[model samples]
Target: MDNSQRKLGTPKLGKWELFAYGQLVVPMAVIGLPLAIYIPPFYSGTLGLDLGAVGVILMLARLSDVFVDPFIGRWSDRTHTRWGRRRPWVIVGVIIMMISAIMLFVPQGQVTNLYLLVWICAIYLGYTLIEIPYGAWGAEISDDYHERNRITGSRQIFLLIGLLIAITVPIVASQAGSGATAASAASRQAMAALGWLTAGLLPICLVILLRSVREPVKGHSVPISFAAGVRVAMRNGPLRMILATVILGALASSINAGVAVLFFEHVAQMGSSSSVLIFALFAAGVVGSPFWVSIGGRIGKHKGIGVAGFASLAAFALVPFIIYWVKPNYPGAVFPAMLVITLIQGFSIGAAPILGQSILADVVDLDTIRSGEQRTAFLFAFLAMVRKFFEAAGVGIALPVLSWIGFDPQSHANSAGANFALTAMYCLVPLALWIVSTTIIWNYPITHERQARLRAALDRRTARRARVRAAD
Candidate 1:
């Protein structure tokens, strides 16, 4: 058994295929964006879940991702279906997303703390079924490093779009209902709409992937024990660095996301439309996302990522200073200042995933050389777990500190300490962490030249094997 034997088909990505791959963003965002942005705030403020309780539930829910991701990833890797290794799981994940999105909206009536925790656990588990497989599918679908970046960029863009749409839910619901208090009905309606919309878009995009990209077959299962497989992957230096940078970056970003609502609602006084403002920044990132990919292609992935992280650090570090300088000094100019910070961040945020995926592609190539197996999906699963754990730790630590700082959602503005916490989390802390992440990336060993060498060797081996088969 060899890589060639595992494939159902090999087709170049055509325009429609690209479109389909890009369309996956919708489902990804629909299913994922709300958990971070809307769910926490809604539970804490609207449903009367205590901030501390909300934080605990969120932390616990994210931790569940650690267990679920690898299991699903490993299963998806070994799965053989007429539809293909990735698509069947991709479809199943979407169906689960449709159901769970609805579950999230179902108001479990005045519940005990235990009941609420149980409901939250269910939601988190369902989300893992959707997210982990979906991410692995992205990695598995393309072997070309640049093509993978394009696919990932398209995915991230749609993800941003989904975030934009999700952000509008509160506003849309408010307008549909009489006011904020009764917007749950409106939200329910929105989720229903999103559910069907994602369900529809997913299959369509997958068709594009199915039709356009020919997956390399997992023709031969390595005889190595699974434990040995795990060991080989863990010991890979390039993969480890990529994982480290991603975990650190995810931690920093998750903490920033957890605190951003506070910054917008209280510090900036964006009011009920604060969600819109925050999402618009995300949308702006979606808009700017391609440039990052293009930059990576131009300068090389590692340098491109370094540049993007540097920009994010600068933008994040400037937020508080600009706010303080402009708020009383030039009241009307505050929005502009905030916009500047967000606009820059939008471009910078895309760097990690785009570069990370490219690096992962290289790791896949390397793994084949060292371990004599293509277990890209398995490695991605490992990443899925590491990413979830650190993200949990980030939100876990930040939320409790925020609660202790008296971050009452009902308060018109946070108390001075609460304000300090929000500002620091959103601005200062992330800026510092981004700097550290970039420094780690600077040490990344996979150069474009190295990738070229690996690919050339793989190609020659493939060609020689083909010639041997012909002679036989």
Candidate 2:
């Protein structure tokens, strides 16, 4: 359970072992999907916080990661504990996450924005501690491209399973008490249950992952200074492009998520059944992840992601048109079309994270060639900032736009312009970004052949270094 794990060296992860390692993502994903999709609305509808205030507070909390994540990543890299570099941070993170989850989510009385902000900050801090280190560990555990796809794909599948669980909570609450649209006491209690479930789940899974998996074999590392890490992180060409694709893709997805509930409530009018639609979308991602991994193996990861972006772009572009066409006698009909389009988009969802992480490992491999060290921790930390920034940015933008379009509490029966604003933000804006991300990712230089060559060269370098050490 401690640094004694470090001496076990790099062990080949078998299929069941991979499954156990991936199982750990479920707890974090359960926490994550709700944080992005549910918590803001939970605060606004149930707790009576203003939309803008919630947006700003959440944005600030996420923005703090721009500064905080690098240090956490660096600390994990340098950590030489018996529990291994990643496990200690993950353990501490789980405790903080549990405490914060209970305090922020299961409110007994009136709570202030300040209270919400403080707890949100704590939750995100713990989230960062776990996610950044854990991601680095995954990258370190493998060098084979197809094998990594299996690793990341397995983890992504678990993540989708968690999101599916989070998605069901609304339906459970709706049937138990007031219907889902109202955000009533039933819904609040359901969310409270979710928090406690996550609190219970994290420790169990943390124990499983630590006992099951071990880190990769690493040669001597000339510790990367923060300044040097920053320089390499910036100077690396593919990393920059990868970061760009990640940011833009996240921006698009986040924008769509920001207005999804509103679109369901005001425009589509799906009511409590909204969770079903959301669940379908995520379920598709679960089914599609392995397919994407296979496709990435066939093509390059970057090109595979481009195909996903194109598919997502087409899906989002069709959304408003479907809504527009279905608005009158067939307003309910739009939900089916939404499900189909989102199912198509789900292919992209599965591809993005799996390939993004896989490519980061590839990029880190190249960085190791140059710097003579494995720096997965800080490198992945940089990627995490891109994802966090866009997630916050998307929500931040959506809330203000709603206010500007005259969407207030009484305005669920929104004006034509307000409706127009919702559709445009929900569909077209994301569509545009999706196009850009696809274009950028399509030409990304790393290919399967190139990665093979890179690995071969690195092996030769390692053997030469070993020969030199033996002579000394």
Candidate 3:
């Protein structure tokens, strides 16, 4: 069948296609979970590298993407092959990730700060290749507003599932060994397991996705230079608003992830149960995805994000109080209280990425109408860069700050001041950023009504182009 025929036949993606698309995220989460949560402490505490140096290395590695992301994005948009524009990059990314996962996750003899820096940079480069194109691919899958939610929502569910699996591996691996493993040893074991899991599942998932899902046909449009494309994207008001929220939300999430294990271990006195707690957190996110998506449909995408942000803010606000005050009064209540708080926070986690990307897809429509070019991947690349840069920044800033404050990850006898610093970094910083992000996005200009009007105008333009071509 021709491209138009295929597009007409599948106005909505089939379940199997969504399933295949979502599976790709599973391995990504497996790799990502440890990088954000486990790897910092593993390298610094277990391997005896300087904590501050490790943070700087990771942050610098992500900074490399400042040059890398936009290039990959523009390349993917311009690429044409029998396999497809996005898939070819995904193929290259899988190979890069597989090799780097083995090196970083399953380290060999004499690991050092330099070793950590090199391998981490390699892995992040691989991630950018896949993530930029993958996001653009999803945005192209369907034009309907709600269908965009379904596309992103499906990915969110699988992303959470992958996170659950990632955490479960370490919990099972640590428990399966001898009695009472040290935190550092447990983290090392977890990394090894995660390495194998990622290497094994990544290629298998890639094969399934490539075989099952077909890329959509590209419509005719005016081609623009990269410089011009960047200029046009800057002028897009909705894109700016959405990206502003993305920066804050992603920065908040990165801060929380960077220090979560440390805070739980040192502050909440829940080190041994860290994986279980995280598993519970992401599990709640899995269950809550559908509810948040429904809320987006009911109220509006931006408002739904606002509600989730408030829920997250409330949950984060309780952390310091629970650990510092409530624990002193009723020691037994801390874990239960923290568990409830974690669940509440995770439930709100699904809305940001799910609804945010949906909003971004609409913004892409607006840009298309104005610029007369389809630059979905390029725009998605900018979002990905912001997320990675800030995620790295969060770890980069948090770890060094903790070190400067004399908080030792290996020592149990951290001073009261050090413990309080960890708590504030984990809780208060994210809470403040979430408040800013929610405020910026709560009144986003693109609603369902506005998006429908944009789509109609594009449709009219497409029809006009067809008539002119026929006359010629």
Candidate 4:
């Protein structure tokens, strides 16, 4: 909006803005779609990493995030440039991610034990560089709570589309082959192709976001030091609650991703088609993104999140009993329950990222009013750190558990240990994490009324400053 036309409660986003925001979601694939869901099993089965080693490698990568994400967010916050603070970092990050994805698939011969570890580090570093800046940008672009939801929701829809395409392509390639053995080989080749396709699209998305979105004008000065910005954000109760919920919620979702494939393939023994079904389940979450976002705005962010979390908890809780009860008595029932549970999990997790993130924007504005600083990017870095930590922790736990279960993936569905491991991973771990997240969110303090007051108060201050400059 033009300077004179802007007012409190003004719609901060237009069609173009929403489009650009949606476009931003494309890059989420660079960081999210692969590692959290697809890569662990891919590395273990395809690239020849053992389950235990794969788990350790993932843990190390997540630990690295603790060190890098905050610094990256701080850098994006402190940067002053014509391209805007978050955009420049995003550009750098995208380039890094593209390189990492390429490196991820580079064919490796039978190798030393360290092969997976080395590649995982490269992948983690690349993703952290890209995602931290990309996530931070979401908060910098809009101050409206609902607008934040719209932008994030639109971004999520395209993100899910990217995920669906990435996932389904491999399945289709596998199916096109002449036989079962050939199908697995064909699927691998298709996966490589899909990686390259995504690599190609990454730059296109970067250009679209760079050319399309304009960062909103800042009304007041804020210090840029990392320590100062973090201090400001931590002091806010509402932001802290949101950050805590995100951390716990992300942990649950990450654990589910790490384990779901194992669950379907081993415990359920549903065959090659199960991969496609699982992908569909993951895609289900993405499809429901807009619905979740709208729900958050219509009710409230906390209430919406609480509802989603409850659904996820219930669905995951039932998975174990369902698997045990129906797998022997009624094999057909297993697949449907698996699909339903995963869909519920996806819907809840997908909504959390979009809606929980919108609250971060509100927190930044509230901080701006209370402390007179605009350090949205830096504040969000803490949230990113928490998210990264939990994803790693999930992998850390899953790897060893998978090992203990004797997940001789080459053996397929006959391994009892593998079957038990899958059930534990998908059903139990997620339920525990969901419970914690729900509790944390129940007491979250940023109501619509409180946020509106913060916005109105900030607007009046800006108006007064404008009048002073005019009189002078």
Candidate 5:
């Protein structure tokens, strides 16, 4: 078919197709929560690895993505297959992730730091394989300004649901057996259950997604060298702006996730309620996804993200104060106050994943217009790599800092200074990062009108190329 005919024939993705695509995030989120929140504690406290070592090892594992993500992105973009560009990579990722999940989550014997490093690195590699291409696939599904919001919004909703399931699984598993189970043993049980759940759900979700959704027809696949792609990405102003925000924002989130349980258990003195609180947080995100999407439509995507970041900042700013002031004076009111703050922050959670990704899809259009090649996956990979780098940095920094401050996760009691340090790291640092991220993207230049123009230019360019080929 000709360019015009293909453009005319592009189908609006049905709800079922969107749901099928979104379903894949469930298993991924299942693994993600444990990696971010539970893994360090599990490996460090239960499995006898040092806290600082776990932090550094996980950081190194994620750093491995520095090379892997870009290579996979470029390879997937250049790959030609009957199954399509993105799907095949996703299939391979599923197999790798499944194997790694079993080994990492369900450890067999007395595993060492090296074992943790190897399996965690493998899992992250698998995650990169799926995430970079999976994100690019979603971007290719639609080019509409508002429709992109819908696409990402759907995925974000599922993502939150998956996180909620991840949180609930441990809570339920911990409670299912004798209530007297030691914390470490309970954690082990939870991880084992999660591993099996991930192993079972991944293939099923993959089959459904592969069967239900058709990959979008490629407009063109001009193979750009990795160096050339990097050069092009460097020159993209919007992409640079987005990456800056991604680094700051992801680092903030990583720190928060790294020390959240420590803060709740040691600083806040509410260990039992941590799981429920996290569940509430993500449940709020599930509810807030569409609200942020609507806000994105009414305002602009970047401004919407700025607004959400501000909201989160306000919520985080209250955390340390609440722990220090409210807990001592009216100890009974602390959890309720924290619950309120967490829900508020959670409501704003949808802004980044839903809108940030939608914004990146728009940025991809800008790059395509400039480079005359569809490098969507490569650009997404670039952003993903930046995000992972900072995320790893956050964990790498937070844990060692905690260890240095004399905060011990294995013990119930910590020094006042250590508790203060946890509070500051968990609350103040993220607050500062969010402020910077919000400032960077508040007036992002690519408005809806600009993206429409970019799309038009791409269409004209495609049509011109088609005519030349016809003439030949």
Candidate 6:
């Protein structure tokens, strides 16, 4: 909004407060990255579970989140506590998450599919508990359009920091000829260290946020059944567009992540260099966060996200060329080429989600303005559900497809055909998903100007209610 018009109850969180709020996501990324990239390999590659079976188990377990996320969101909205709605859930979720983080990562065993399923479900459940409500909390914490962008971006920076830390472990271990070696003493020790770090950090981060960042007071959720809430959520038009964006983005991202270790290890032949490439990728994100926040401010977050999507596509376009041309002919240049590509891709990777999330706050505002109910948590929860569903589906398909294409990590040396399959899985699938995501978000309905209008109208109605109550 211009200087002439600032909406009431527009939150202005200071830098430190925003930092405090964003810090909680660090350990989350540390724990979560393994689930997506490392732990799957650890199980299928290290523990000797069949790839197809691991994929199925992972899908079913994480898929359980679709049910739990919305319920938790609904419960979060309905809760009334002196500590506040989201924080209570945060506390509970973090405790569950820390315990499960240890379970998922720290185990040394003759790994059973059942054991994997149980802990994966526990981690997903705990993650959902924190992530959905936590996301909703950020949505409600501020009303300013650009300020919300700043909040999401700031948090993303810290998320990248955690990622860099988490990813650095494997890179360094590999340099020492130890980590990501798969089913080795050094690998187990490296993973154990990561587990302990995650378990240790989850609570510390949550405690800082709980002590520092204040939750905006909210009344009980609109009295509606979960069924009705789903209907209401569906009826929100802009939200539907955003949901499509989330799913498509999730699909592209999950596929790339699920395939990353294998693709790098075999196709790109990155080997010990994989970890370094990952660290560089997220480091690029760290550098890109503010650039994206600026872009959001200038062209608006939707267009900004569109820009990011296109940028990501452009960067991804280089992947195949790098794999085919650089890796085969100029072997040493492969790592450097990938380093550049991932860093550039990371720039957009850094931007798209932060912008999408920032845009979601505005979209949620549109929902509140239309429905006359601030059902933030449920909407965020539903978005989380869609994302998880797609992520599970993508990984489920991607992993099995890898096996079908002869990705025999057991053999530790894939054939040329298998490497080609890895290239297609890594590059082509994600390229298609990114294009779809870009198209989905290209004409997003809510803009900054529009969001300001909605917020002002809501403020006027809120003032009217206060006056009526005082008169009574």
Better of 1 and 4 by lDDT: 4
The C-alpha local distance difference test score for the whole of candidate 4 amounts to 0.71
Lowest lDDT block of 10, candidate 2: 1-10
| Best by the lDDT measure | 5
Best of the two (3, 4) by lDDT: 3
lDDT by residue for model 4 (25-58), tens? 5645634565666566677776666778778788
How far does residue 409 in candidate 6 sit from its true spot (Å)?
Answer: 1.3
Please report, as a residue range, the 10-residue window in candidate 4 with the lowest summed lDDT.
178-187
Candidate 1 TM-score, true structure as reference? 0.88
Which ranking of candidates, highest lDDT first?
A: 5, 3, 6, 2, 4, 1
Each prediction's whole-model lDDT (CA): 0.69, 0.79, 0.85, 0.71, 0.86, 0.80
TM-score of each: 0.88, 0.94, 0.96, 0.89, 0.96, 0.94
* Total clashing pairs for each candidate: 3, 4, 0, 0, 0, 0
Over 1-472, each residue of candidate 3 has an lDDT whose tens digit, in order, gives 3332446224567788889888899999989988888888889877889888988998898887766788798889889987789999999999999999999989988898889988999999898889999999988888888888888999999999999898788776765654444344346676788898999999999998888877888877888988888889889999888878878877887888888888888888875666567888899999999998899988999999999988878777888788778999999888889888889988988998899888898999999998898878888897788878888788889889999999998899999999988988888988899899899999899999999899889888988988998999
Q: Which stretches of model 4 miss by more than 4 angstroms? A: 1-12, 108-115, 176-187, 346-349, 413-418, 461-472
lDDT of 2 by residue, 221-288 (tens): 67767888788778888888888877987887787777777777777766655666778878999999
Error of 2 at 431 (Å): 1.3
Cα lDDT tens digits, model 6, 405-454, are 77886676678888788788788988898898898888987887888898
Per-residue lDDT value at 44 in model 3: 86
Candidate that beats the other on TM-score, 2 or 3, i.e. the better one: 3
C-alpha RMSD for every candidate: 3.8, 2.7, 1.8, 3.1, 2.3, 3.3
In model 3, residue pairs whose N, Cα or C atoms come closer than 3 Å (at least 3 residues apart or on different chains), thus clashing, are none
Superior by TM-score: candidate 1 or candidate 6: 6
Expressed as tens digits, the lDDT of each residue in 1-472 for candidate 5 is 2221223225456788789888899999999999998998889887889999999998999897776787788888888898889989999999999999999999978799999999999999899989999999888888898988988999999999999889888777766754633233237778888899999999999998888777677885456666777888899999889988999989998998888877877788776777668889999999999999999989999999989988878887888778878999999989899899999989999998899999999999999877778988988888788889999999999999989989888887788888888988888998898898899999799999999899898888888888988999
Off by over 4 Å in 5: 1-11, 180-186
Candidate 1 segments exceeding 4 Å error: 1-12, 179-214, 219-223, 460-472
Candidate 1 vs candidate 5, lDDT winner: 5
